[model samples]
Target: MSAVNDTSFNSAVFLLTGIPGKEDVHLWISIPFFLIYVISIVGNSVIILIIKTDPSLHVPMYIFLSMLAVTDIGLSMSTMPSTLGIFLFNYKEISLDACFAQLFFVHLFSFSESSVLLLMSFDRFIAICNPLRYASILTLPRIAKMGLVCALRSVALVFPLPFLLKRFPYCHTNVLSHSYCLYQEVMKQACSDITVNSIYGFAVKLLAVGLDSLLIFLSYVMILTTVLSVTSSTESIKALNTCVSHVCAILFYYLPDIGLSVIHRFGNSSSNLPQVVMGYIYLLIPPLMNPVVYSMKNKHLRSRLFKAFCK
Candidate 1:
């Protein structure tokens, strides 16, 4: 593949990279990736279906969960085609527009997922700390409005990314680091001055995901404090029990994400294999595991899922 120098953004193409040194076994590798995509799709879809069809789950917590399922599905869809294409078909060439579009949706859903998790944290906080007001505070219309705000925030922040990258000329190798596009990976490929792109990208991640994480942390802190203040041990246990699934969700999503970011920023350049593995773990595991976590933790959801499967 030739280097892209002084090329128009519309005409430029990027070669997506599969696992380093594992190109010969890409077909074999695709089996697990394909299964991941299928399970993520089916799992999140089932979660959404159960939430939507079950009148009993029409509360704030489950509403946020349904939103999360949708975001997971969106994230899976955003990465699936290019990822599976590279591994299964050796179709690694991606057009500039398509790459940018994929990056946008991937980050969009990712940020929105963080936001939904924060919202869920708040849901738990209110439900546990101030149970009497929970119904008044998190009504359906209010939840809908909150979801809209999260969607708009994600779009508003992510929409400018493609345009910002497009303004820069890529005179270096256009081969990307991952099978699917990422903002940082794509920005590194540009030959021109990327100071603005780098600053803006960092700022966006800090503002969106970083802030959401901080708030989620604070929400949990308050939750724990509230639980401790309860006079009855049974009440405390019940309150904490309600948060088990959400806590699992948070850990599954953020731990891998934080590890991936650390690997990207500080990892050795010679270790492409670890970086690629972390990327897959960061992107695929949360979506694949969230439904399972929720199903196992929530008795109602577990029963519904079992009935659905048995049927």
Candidate 2:
């Protein structure tokens, strides 16, 4: 890999776009964007608040749900500043330091969310497949440790990204597809050889998001196996019902990412609108829908939220 000591490369500025080729309609688009920001912030906030205040929700499932809510809040907030600037105020310039900082937090929360989802799936597996040992297996201390590990794992893995990029020179075009910075998106503009960055980035993705997804799927398979072995249909339905919200949460988190990947892989690169929409869905939909999904599926949370709002 080549390194450049040019001051201009180090001080390069990146330009972020809202929706390429759709700038004319951005004014109207800002309406939904603004609403999404508001809903995600308020919705996840309510979930966190509810989980904290309700003594009955002091269980492993609820604790994981609270962790998911916190991650959603961080993920949403990471993109909102630049996204709102692009859509509402037409602010497109982002310094290298600021861009890298945003990139760090964005990936940090994304990986953390993936980690929490995996843990939540494991929680379901234990609660369903090993009911008697559920409480014994996942005590409060263990749960806290799991949460800490998730946070630390994400931070440690993504911490090297910005510094890695900084070592390279960005002398090429600085335009990015989305308003926020991403690892692959930023590294593509570097003049130096990015072989190391690409390899390391893929390794991290494979180990964190890809590996976590595989394990979560295996957890559900085990859960299904246990559910089927139960004798009574009523009991089987009850066992599966508890997993609906979590399954929905998983779908919400991964489907858009898959779609965006497909779009980028096959769709015409000249057409940026599709990529932009899919990217927004990846970031916005989960945070907005997660609370709604959990509250509706969980009767206790639903009732508490109802009473909380009514008062």
Candidate 3:
């Protein structure tokens, strides 16, 4: 494995679905993605507005919610334009630089979203376990700090991807599988082997993804124990229902991502469709489903949102 550290190496070219320069998947891809994008934006925007407009929602939970809406918008903005642009112009040629840019931003927003979720878990923990201290624990400054930390963490961890990719000379082969430059696919064309890249990627997942998830798990565990100690079945049921949407969102979003990662790593090519389905499920589903999940369950916020829409 020779090290091809050519900083100026050009990215290789690849065709979509084996058709050289054909945008045949444009309409089929664009229509669905566009619809989903609109839904995501609107749903998230409404949630944000409701949270902001309603004084009743000015709590830690809703602040985290507003952060989620912002993150969802950023998430959509990061990925949707290039995707929609590719389809609209029927132009499928993505340069190496552009591909790396997309990958970095995608991961950046993804990391932010995960961090926000972790903060939310802590929010719920404080509300449930130490209700008396909830306000002091999650003050405006604390919340602001959490958001800042997430933003900084995202930029810090994700900013390194493009730089690492730079270490490899893209001798050729820019054929990206799927609409974007999926990491494994681009890394596959490394003129120099990216064993370290694979390691870094795994380490990122372990630290950022794994540790964030572990904290969420612990927060929930404490919440569950506290709820159990209530001894009132009615209170337990009510608390359970209150967290239903968030719990479902967590399970649905992470379950598909975990599934896709396993299949992509271990399964053969015959699993491409499932992998593809899971890809959309991983990216689009959370943003799409999140607002709906919260709206359907969160009566106070949802009622305000509906009232705003009605007016």
Best by lDDT: 2
C-alpha lDDT score of every prediction, in listed order: 0.90, 0.91, 0.76
lDDT of 2: 0.91
Backbone collisions counted per model = 0, 0, 3
lDDT of 2 by residue, 22-67 (tens): 8888889899988998998899999889889888999999999999
Error of 2 at 281 (Å): 1.0
| TM-score of predicted structure 2 | 0.96
Cα deviation at 18, candidate 2, in Å, is 0.8
Backbone clashes, candidate 2: 0
TM-score, cand. 1? 0.96
Q: Write model 3 residue lDDT over 21-101, tens digit each, in one string.
A: 445666776788899999999999988877887788888889998888788887787777666767776566767777888
Deviation in angstroms for 304 in model 1? Answer: 1.2
Cα displacement (Å) at residue 224, model 2: 0.6
Better of 1 and 2 by lDDT: 2
Model 1 agreement with the true structure over 1-311: per-residue lDDT tens digits:
23443445448799998998888999999999999999999999989998999999898888999999999999999999999999999999998889999999999999999999999999999998889999999999999999999999999999999999887766567987788999988998887788898899889989898999999999999999999999999999999999999998899888888887888888898767787888888899889999988988999889989998999
Off by over 4 Å in 2: 1-5, 262-267
Task: For candidate 3, give the lDDT of residue 235.
Answer: 85
Give the CA lDDT, 0 to 100, for residue 297 in model 1.
90
